[model samples]
Target chain A: MKTTLIFLVIFCTSIANAQTLEVGLRVQKTQEMYWENGVSAQFSFAKFKPEQFFLGLDYVTSRLGTAYQSNAIKQDSYLLSGSWLFNKNKPYHIVTRFNMGYFYSDLEEDMFAAIPNTSFLVSPEVGLKYNFKKMPISLNLGVGFYIITAKEGYSPGTLQPLYYHLDLYYSILKTRKK
Target chain B: MKKISFLFIYILVTISFSCSGPTITDDLLDGEVVFDPSLYNPEQFLVSAKYPIPTPADLNKHIILAVHGYTATTFEWQEFQDWSVTPSYRISQVLLGGHGRDYNAFKNSTWEDWRSSITSEYEKLIALGYTRISLVGSSTGGTLLLELVNSGYFNNHLHPKNIFLVDPIVVPSNKLQTLVGIIGPMIVYVETDQTAAENNYWYRFRPYETINELNNVMSIVRKGLENGMTLPSGTYLKVFHSLHDPVASTTSSVLIYKGLKTSSGSKIEVQLIYSDIHVFTRLNLRTKVTLLQKNNQLDVFNQIANKLN
Candidate 1:
């Protein structure tokens, strides 16, 4: 996993012109399921579409949301996405993205070890993003649907297909000027 | 964007136009024409009714109450009763309230109403001096049993010796089941796609209100499991689920395993059958049956029988 993360980082940073690295929060809620909140980070390049394209990573868990100090199932998700922005000049732009990820829920007991609590995830998303030019903040909203290939009982029940998410990104490093 | 909007509107309009719910009819089991015999002649279906005044020999044998699922009647357990010819144990096929009646009754019933028959039969058995009692629930029936456990129903009553769940639906395989509240108005009721013979035993039309009721009981049970529950002292539980169940997901059993504990706090037993159908035990009216299916049914029946003995 570490090697894949390193490879992705290197590949994304070398894509066009390594410029800015934006980091902040991602809050996601699955339809009729869990509310998972976690961190999101994206890297931007100056050329080859400049701010229009991005490579990002997200890590979210129910531990920070519904399961906190409660008996709700504890689950975690990790995602890698490549996003494209439309109408790059506007403060608000349309966002289209594809994400590949993994999901796992803690059953918390060894006896339940045989139960399916993990899954592979693939999703396509579309939403809108609003950027505050003066501040280092951007608000992004997206609706995504996972294409679940595993049969019903073979996959985790909480890993539902549809989800809505809001991401708040802070510019940790500014991109190079065109 | 324009095309997507147009398509969404078109689909909504189409469904809105097609939303004429069913009315009572003789051909449909949801109508007032037919009813489960258990409602009238409980003497035949329920053991409690047959032996309201049990002899010493009757009290010594174990009595296992069999509860059926949503929209189902006592016929669901008719096979088990016929299969078990031994006098060591008896099967009480309890027909849920408002079930095997008419459409209006089913539509108007709540989850609590559906559970009344099980409790009523249990209480009757207890009152008759039957000390050794167990329970076996299938599909929604299993979920109802879970609710009973969480609600402390057995605390005051005689604790059951064992509880067996088959294809219990804590989580429905259909994801859209949770969205009944939103789409329920647009679609007043859901029609069943069952064989002619099957219609006599189960409700043909499912009202949106009853769907929500199912959702309610399922939600309650799921929450209770998450909060952790214990069986009554000396009581045990065993869950049987089809690995590829198309109605009740196997996750239901998984959650039950993770949440419920034996009276002694040990993990309950679970067996996952490699089958594609739900409630593998009920093969009486099925159009076709396979050898594997029969074996699966026999396997569970024997295990339950062994436990009861």
Candidate 2:
């Protein structure tokens, strides 16, 4: 996991120029999904169609909610995604995204080590993004399905297949001019 | 940026408020009794109260003790009790300890207390000389039945002729259910999204301590499944599950099939219904019902009835 993060950081930073970096807070709900709150960071390549398309990373968890605070269940989802913005100049753009990721759950019991703790995740989503004309923030709402491949009883029962999420983003450190 | 920050704050506030609210209730143990007299009154449900000695007619007939799931009461099995009109068999509704009473009573109950009810009922029937006995449990009740078998409780007592499980929840389908150990203390009780009508029977709020106890039993049973368990000699077991049970996953049935074995060293029987509800046998309180749903319940009922014959 450390190696993957280091690799992602190095790769995204190397192409800093001509890239649009945005950091945001994400709130999501799947079909019967518990309230999951998290941080999202995405860097869109400047040279690779500017803001029209981008590679992104997001981390969402249930740590901040009553679900986690009350010791009901805690979950974390780490996703790497590719997104496309049609008609980038429009204040409102159609966004299509595909995310590949990992899901981890802590059962808090030593006896459950043999039970499934992690799963490979893939999600395909479509939604609308509205960028304020004057402010540096963007708001996005989309729905996605996690194609969890784990077998029955091995995966978390709450992590069902379908979900919907809302993203609130802000422009962060700009890419250096080439 | 200020406007955006303000917007961000507004969005955060809105989303945070959108979280599902907690289920708070007056504890049942505050002043109320632990058991529901109306439900447990021998004049009403406990057939044993009416017939202390088996009528020659009741003698030797198959008697099934029906057990309900966690946070549930005898209502879970009431439909079956009502449906069984045949003279060949009868239903004994066993109320788990701390159930069918009040929130305080349920909140203070333990899993062992829950299992004790089943044991006591079984013992009573055994004492009455009911040699042909079977057990039918739904969800947690099913888990308790399996625990009894895994712990060899059946070996010391009279072996049940058959054990029927309906969506026994070894593996919960709700993803958050698994994390109770870590998230339980901070969120003391998990609230159910139940209607007022449903709340009349099931506990709308679940206490953390009771949840912990449930996890303990589930862990014990899950490990037993992993290690494998054998039915008591001469006992038969069959599991029935919904194809899409939202509460208890159908995979639980699969685990039971893989882990539990007959005394003859053969695989136990399992049937997967093509329905999509948990405890498909209970049709009341459901908002919608299809022909398939009714058929699913009848199929299991018929199967159990057939075994009795």
lDDT value for candidate 1?
Answer: 0.86
The whole-model lDDT of each prediction reads: 0.86, 0.77
TM-score of candidate 1's A chain against the true A chain:
0.90
Q: Write the per-residue lDDT of candidate 2 for residues B1-309, one digit (tens) a residue.
A: 999999788767655643533544443322243344435485456556656887767866888888999888888888887888888888888888877776667778899999998998788888888888999999999999999999999878999999999989876776666556655655667777776667767777787767878777876786687568999988889998876677886656756776789998898988777766889899989888899899888899889989987
lDDT of 1 by residue, B143-257 (tens): 9999999999999999999999999998877766666765776778888789888888899899988999998998888888877889999998999998778778777887788
Global Cα lDDT for candidate 2: 0.77
Docking class of 2: incorrect
- Show the lowest summed lDDT stretch of 10 residues, model 2 chain B: B26-35
lDDT of 1 at B128: 88
